[model samples]
Target: MSDKMKKGQGPADEEQNAQWVASRSLMNVGSLDESGYLNSFYRQGYNLSKCLSESFANAKDAGADKIVFEDTESYNRIIDNGRGMSRDDFKSMFSFQKPNHSDRKSCGISGIGGKIAQCILSNKKTSTTYTFNGDEYLVANAPWDRMFEYGVFSDMITIDNMNQYQIDMFNARTNGNTGTIIEFPRNDDVIDVIKQNFSRNNKDDKQSKMECVYNPCDMINVVFGGFRLDISYKRRDGEVEQMQMYDYFGEESEKYYDGKTTRTIEHYYDARKDISRYILKADDVQDESDMEIPRVGRGYSKDPRKVSAPYEGYIKKGEYVAVVGQRHYTDMDEEPPETIIQCYDDRKKCFYDEQFEEGISDHRAPLYRNGQMIGKFHCSDVKYTNSRANSKSYHEIKSVQLKLSYSTHCTQDNLLDKCMGIQQNKNQFQSEDMPVNLTRLLGYIKKDKATMIYKYFESIRTQPISPSQPSEVEQPVSPSQPVELRQSVEDSMTQRSVNGYVTGPLTPIQVTIALGINIGDLTLETLTRLGKDRHIIAMFNAVNK
Candidate 1:
């Protein structure tokens, strides 16, 4: 026997000695209430996909390149090519209610992901976890039923030398390298729940089942690069079907033509205020179209007159521009629904926009923190609904989707901080402060620019064109027509003089008509002095009319 094995040997054998030491250490060091800790997770809410996502996140944190999920006749296994756990790590994993690992940037900040998953999977049954390190291995056997019966966590858990079957399973999955393998008795209910939860169709209806079949490959695609998850299952015909991470989800293709238009606003950290502020503004861009129309002056007048000035057709660009597209959920024959104006805040990862349908409240955006969606906000002025599939009252906007996103630093804004303070279940934020902040922020958005752009395109689509006259139609004019045409031109000029305002710089004829004098009587100095005087210009325009 090797020196290490010989040294570990006791009365019965090395294997028996290892088991005793493991059990003793667990009892001596593990000081936590397993049942209470697990109950807390249940109270918080247990999502099957979230549990699995936590496991995958852990694997990524460990720098694992490959992960596998296999269903055997007796057990279901999840194996990963991650750095195997040390003795301390193995113990710490089960030490419930612990904080997150300080070094890892993991989403499982509570450090209960693996424990919750394992306990739920075992469900009072026996489960095994093996961790391999070089030539040595550690095994943890969890007999949950026995532990619950004894009311002591250490009584049900045993740390021992790995058995041959476990060694074989580990070798086959990790190619005999250092890694971790978890196994539990095959439970169809758990497997079905996982399949249903991770399915893409559950994006909108997370709580209930839909007609779509579960595709593990697509699920992997949705959460790609974080970790690799593969599933191996047997078909009814006795053939094994294996699925690996694919490059695209089913909805990705649909987004190609009907994706949301996005604009990003970056803010640098400010040291003075100890917060970052992103100022949202839209820039004006000249329209490229060659078509020209008359430019109308602002406000109303009883006698409106067109000047020599033409419309420049300048349009607002940058963040001020809003996306105008057909509704994603309309049929071909049906008229396209109204444009939806969506605003997404990237920092908070929340959206604020008008609701599609009428409900009790006008809330339409879902709030999120640390990637997990919490709840909705219903401030009177700026209400938002939870975006989760389980929300009982979801609001939809039929027309004008306006999406906007705020930076993470903006959450620290006084108004937002107060609103977020009263959040429940991280799900809903209720405070008058929310509406106050939202109203202030939205004031910067130029809705008139979006409306002008929408109208410009709408006119092109609806305007009717008159047919051209045929070449065979001959035209002739009498001599008297030329004299009448000149008389009409003079009459039109006289009418314009009656209605036009003499403001700013004016031509000789304009000044002559405005002052009711001949052109020869007007001097450059006189015209400049009269143009600058609002009272004189107004009186001259009124007298001419």
Candidate 2:
């Protein structure tokens, strides 16, 4: 071959060349032994359930509520899938100090050992995961396991008799095919997530559960692939319906779940367009075609995230929440994943600080209190970017800007308009055809209001009373003192007395004024034009003067 041809890459040479280039990094330093790889899972902190709940919460907010919410049978299996650390995936999902997982590949990798993504909810609430994996593989990282066992995964002891989802999954994956079964025995603490966000179904059974607890590999897919996912909670009775879908790792999902299957991008975008209604519409997105869901195939086609939450912002509009700061690179590194949460703050008249977060492993879409973060943005999976960690060459950081808008309960930026609990203008106050969106807005509000209403009456029940109870019809007091006992009578007397003082139309206040000219010469019509609050006050003061 000529020198020009030799210098350029051939298909075969490029493959070897790419590996050589990848090997230059520290990722190629040394591979981990099998035992060392298993030790990584031991480092995952307690409160795995809390992390699972946040994943569900975030997924629900972005309109995936329907596809993921589950019952105990399906939820547990998904949890197993997320917590799973097979010999194939990373040696440790949370930490970067893996012996087997090297920086040879250009994929994102982290070595600093911390699990902000999986352990955040522990500070917020207690967590529990119920699965049918015979508890043998039902790994748990609870409080007692931690104080005594250190930062190791405390495996649960179990009998195979209680396994329901496992049996179902085994049936589905009979022979060579492989499938998973997960169940959620209880209502997740993050029910507000779906209540505030998305839904897939109301009362459907028999269909297999669609969500997993979100293990680190899944985290890799979600963080590196831009995958919108969530952890689901399913139960036996129809109590926990299949209303929402996917466990979100907040913004850095599409980077991780960008799996390569026998799927065409053109077909994927086409199907996304056809099912645009099933997909979601956001305001920030202008060219809907430009919004490409990188990976597709097998799942998500039968069920996808629901467009059930209201769009962000009051009708006035302007402030927007868009995803920015991409940490995923095609090259290898030992850096952690991080991103920015950009939103306009009208009061500050500018954007919030250039914030760097560990990144969300789940969606709690900018948790709001009267529409603001109570303390600080909960950053998950955060690590600083570095070009030096793996000693690889040609490292670059690019901020991927996305036209952002939510596809649930509302829409903006050319996406589809979502359905809120309120009826549309056409339907006009009729809830008949109107679908009740997720419970985030009015549901949570109504629940709080209902609690308050109940407590008010309950307080009345607990109040002190006379030992003798009055009969329903019998008089409790004599006619004279009865007036005090008759609440309605006292109210009527007061209203009647006020009515005597003010019965007719509001009486116009009579005032004599010297408008610097003369009130005597001024006509009512002339006075109307000059009537300002200040002028009126001046006229009244002048009259008094």
Best by lDDT: 1
What's the lDDT of the predicted structure labeled candidate 2?
0.27
TM-scores for every candidate against the unseen true structure: 0.46, 0.24
What are the per-residue Cα lDDT tens digits for candidate 1 across 171-208? 87789998888888887775665455334322455343
Across 266-300, the per-residue lDDT of candidate 2 in tens digits comes to 11112222332122233232322212221135322
Error of 2 at 320 (Å): 18
Clashes of each: 33, 88
Highest-scoring model, TM-score: 1
Deviation (Å) of 413 in candidate 2: 35
Candidate 1, superposed: residue stretches over 4 Å from native:
1-41, 47-49, 133-136, 154-156, 197-545
